[model samples]
Target: MPKLQGFEFWKTTLQEARYVVAPMVDQSELAWRLLCRRHGAQLCYTPMFHAQVFVRDANYRRENLYAEVCPEDRPLITQFCANDPEVFVQAGLLAQDHCDAIDLNLGCPQMIAKRGHYGVFLQDEWELLEKMVKLAHEKLSVPVTCKIRVFQDVERTVRFAQMLEKAGCQLLTVHGRTKDQKGAFTGMADWEHIKAVRKAVSIPVFANGNIHHLTDVEQCIQETGVHGVMSAEGNLHNPALFEGSSPPVWEMAEEYLEVVQQHPPCTLSFVRAHLFKLWHHTLQIHQDLREELAKVKSLEGLSEVSRQLRLRCQEEIAKEKEGAEERPRGDLPFPHWMCQPYVRPPPKVLVPNGQSQGSEETKTESHKRALEDSDGTPDSLSKNKQKKKARNPHKTFCLELKPKYMKCEQCGNPKGSKCVFDLCRACCKKKAYKEVADCPSHGLRFKTKADRQRVEEERAGAIGDQEPPDGSQGLPETHNTEQEVH
Candidate 1:
């Protein structure tokens, strides 16, 4: 069965569209999504929600689920998951009235999901997933869609997509990682797998995962050849990465700055979070630049820093232009960070399906800490390193570390120059690994492994605080039973 509004939904979705940012829970909140919408995000999804609580808790409705939605934020979808058709149908009926469409979460791969029986676990039971889809389509007038990941085996993924199509899901998004890889070791998103899903169904298909720039979008299209492309970390890096066509780098950054500045009362924490991701993920090379910019704490500070950085970017662009004018070279030599090998994170082997994604508060805190400190590398580069840059064709040069910040390499000194590798000596002695994993999207390595640990801890705690599903209960202790949304 085709979606009742299938034509309208998909038609308007990518009419002048080049991208749809992936629905990452913490990263894809209304504020970030709106920033993207202003840029080039033609369509996007609210972070996933459990249908049970959406119906049971008014607080969940007002606060977590529908917090930043406004009229301008049209063409948005609220994704929901449920075990019982009746429950989700009730929730979808309500959600469809508010959102342009509603989606089912059939692709989450966390442990909480398996135990809670949602997300990627649904792939295990085709019959149940099909029923959930049919019920949602039958119960709601707005378009019904689902997001999925390619199973480890390609044919299984194809069969699953067919089932979803049969159940009347009008549009589908396929993230390339399977339930098995769990986003570990840079799960190379299998674009070919997404193409297979596209081939299996007639509905518009969007490709997702690891896209960081407009160039990446073009690469994915050239590779997958899908109807549309979606990115979480990519859009997070450059809000204006998507338009009817590829956007210029500085233009994307300028548009984002404009959007953030329009909201004066917004917190420094919020502003920094977006800026940090934009620089680290979207642009490559220049770690000194990335680390320095990562610390600006105020609006004025952002402006001053922007003045200096914009000059640097302009100079680099000019250098490249001159090179092209003189010869056939197109751009400046690519910087160190992108070409250099980077860090890693513990594999998210088992996502607890019931785990909460994260909160604005959590996002704010992570941003605050990431910036508010001096990390590793010397305050000044040694003469030898400078000479090497002037001489070597390809060399891996380390940034100098200020003694104050480079106290040790285990626990990074927050007060010191982005002191990294947990150089706190204390952390070095207690180090789980030699280095810290950088941002998956940005490739900006952490000053210390401790920061990485903190990210994981906070995410776990945030999951604990998740507003529980009705009967698929979650952390009772973490729940703010006293603090209801409404």
Candidate 2:
């Protein structure tokens, strides 16, 4: 195994901080970090940042990079996602002053990551990964680290761990799941593989995944002999896991709310997610309350929900003390809240006819023209023609037998290409794509109210400002009409 610089520094750091908070994309922000620290998380990592965006857009850095650490928040690591070594160096330089270490996000298995040529998709590019790490190690003042998922083969996974260390990764975090084993199939993390990697590498290794409870931390350390254990969903559900069995959801949620209120404000969506995770158990038994919580869009709204849950918890504990029966737990087969598969909307229904009443291509063109025209008016004649063209509604809709398991649904990879992350062959042709761009514009990708508002204003402004090309009455003929596969 290649020896990395600053291993000694991390060795001491890990010795003192055996319980870590994984760098979750939106979940591990300042408020969550502070909560984890209060519950005995020795070290914390910020949400992953895009190196290209961090270096190019000052506005993005200002909006997205919101660590807001204090003296007590030491031993924090800032993770960056990057495909280019130079961009990684630039991003690291900007972040080194605030964080104890710089971590490379090598484990993200989302299709967006693969399309952008970063995260797990870059796993095959050994030399490039090495060079990026080496550049950060040599150029940055702080130590460099990497968080990676294991491969299908244990030998390759072990070699990958060692290669990261050899390339100047002072600390390594190993997530036990393979890149393809996400969502419903996330199953148990392979501790045996983690043990093999820990044995092969001299640097500190942090084991992530399957850390459902506090006891699981000790069990993982005993089995894998890793320097530390990190948790994302588990911690979100019970930020107090590093300490012991969680108190009530209300207690933790209330504490987090207070902490965030004292610091700079966080996005309402983030606050909602944390509160929902903390209350997953309570909500499972209270379907009506869950609907109200789901609609929460402000910290004030969250506080109101927290107030109710806190009172409910208190009431339940009092009832138990008075000999009242305890409420039954959720009957869901999945033990932990994280085990549930991410919910996806039902697929779009095809037009009733076997073929589209009007060609989809023609409709796309008509829509483009509607947007370009000064009046932005719908053509009444075209609508009438389409309505007249409609034939038997019963014959229009088509259904095909859906596969129980699909390797890639986005670009529709062949059955043999069992890669997950929702990637398809179509995306493989693209040179670059933004991972988070495909998400709903109003989702958690925006960190704060101001961030989302700014985006909305910009989007509206751009649309209104657009002008037709010289000598042309409509948008460019080459305007892309096909939807993003993912």
Candidate 3:
């Protein structure tokens, strides 16, 4: 709760005051705010709006400040423009239930500001701004705060701070650039100027401008000696910047896919742009040549590119498995799985005695004969392919007929080992089979009785005094913990 200093809540403090986020209209919508909140932004402000409009138009509020926020988005501010003290106060009071504080925007510098008689145009009108602050303090129960630009002259800016302080505004946020410095090159934010304001004002001061990364937060704190830092464009590019992470790929990639699903399919251009930033770091350590990665242009393309790169990267990671020493790639022999089997079983073998003497040499001779008798050109792959012209007598000896015991549907490998309930190990591993352990979930694999038993044991064990590890807990009702009295 903010301490009641007349109308201003003097004691109310921000939770993550060390790093604050500056608001940008259109780009900084509710979706963006939620993203930032999830990514570690401590404090946030909505884009500056006309207080009069925020109070009057339902559609405007719905489109702008009306966010269906989660509980975690608390301790946030929504900024509004008001040349009139009453307008400012009413807007502030109305915004109290939804936002933590209402920031009075006296710093916006666009042509609209001049036309609306708000923002930078009102910088010269100190008394009106002061009065707006006064009414904001007197009328609104929330903390009264202001966001401003570094003045045209340092002395004049100091005077502006003094005037706002006299109006009962308890906190001031200074964007270190001046009115002339619109867009990127207006000027670098002067930590010196922000420090100057901090020295002059008794209120909490947050230094804004050029805070894009976690390191910037520290540097800004060192330079300005203000209460904290606020960033606008910087937050847009890397939302997790405050926490010192480069960015999270897996979670955000999943979110981007969700956005694509709900908000209509995004253009390939957008996905490529987003993923480019994400995979730029991935590219730094990837073994694939940069030229190979450069060809990617869409989600699918990037997916393929990222897969190829990460697959190779996985091999590198596997090399680093504990106790395993790295070996030269050239020195390693190609795996045995890569080679083609030279022998193929044939139903009959002709010996000089006109009888059967089946051996590897005869099998090799039969394999060559079968391939030679094949319809098309015999390729290197023919040696490994099953000899279609002949069948082996041993197959009947080995294969357990299907539809009884679970049997291999394709190439037979040990008939007794049923892919119970006819499901292959691969499929069972994925579908997490129970009753239908023999069947494949989709098509590629099958579940087993072992899988079902393990699942039942786990399901039974999970009840009562147990908590599942994260989301690995199976369905509650399906996993009946109790057995029959029998």
- Candidate 1: where are CA atoms >4 Å away? 1-8, 12-18, 64-67, 243-272, 281-486
Candidate 2 ranges with C-alpha deviation above 4 Å: 1-6, 11-15, 316-325, 330-486
Q: Name the best candidate (by TM-score).
A: 2
Q: After superposition, how far is residue 47 of candidate 1 from its true place, in Å?
A: 2.0
lDDT of 3 by residue, 228-345 (tens): 7887756654666676765334345445545544443344544554444444444544535344545566566656664565466557557668547764433213221111111112
lDDT of 1 at 82: 75
Ranking by lDDT: 2, 1, 3
- Cα deviation in Å at residue 92, candidate 2? 0.4
lDDT of 2 at 218: 96
Number of clashing residue pairs, candidate 1: 46
Candidate RMSDs in order: 19.8, 20.3, 28.5
- Candidate 1 has what TM-score? 0.57
Q: Which stretches of candidate 3 lie over 4 Å from their true place?
A: 1-13, 248-486
- Which of 1 and 2 is the better model by lDDT? 2
Which run of 10 residues does model 1 get worst, by summed lDDT?
360-369
Q: Estimate each model's TM-score.
A: 0.57, 0.67, 0.53
Error of 3 at 406 (Å): 88
**Superior by TM-score: candidate 1 or candidate 3:** 1
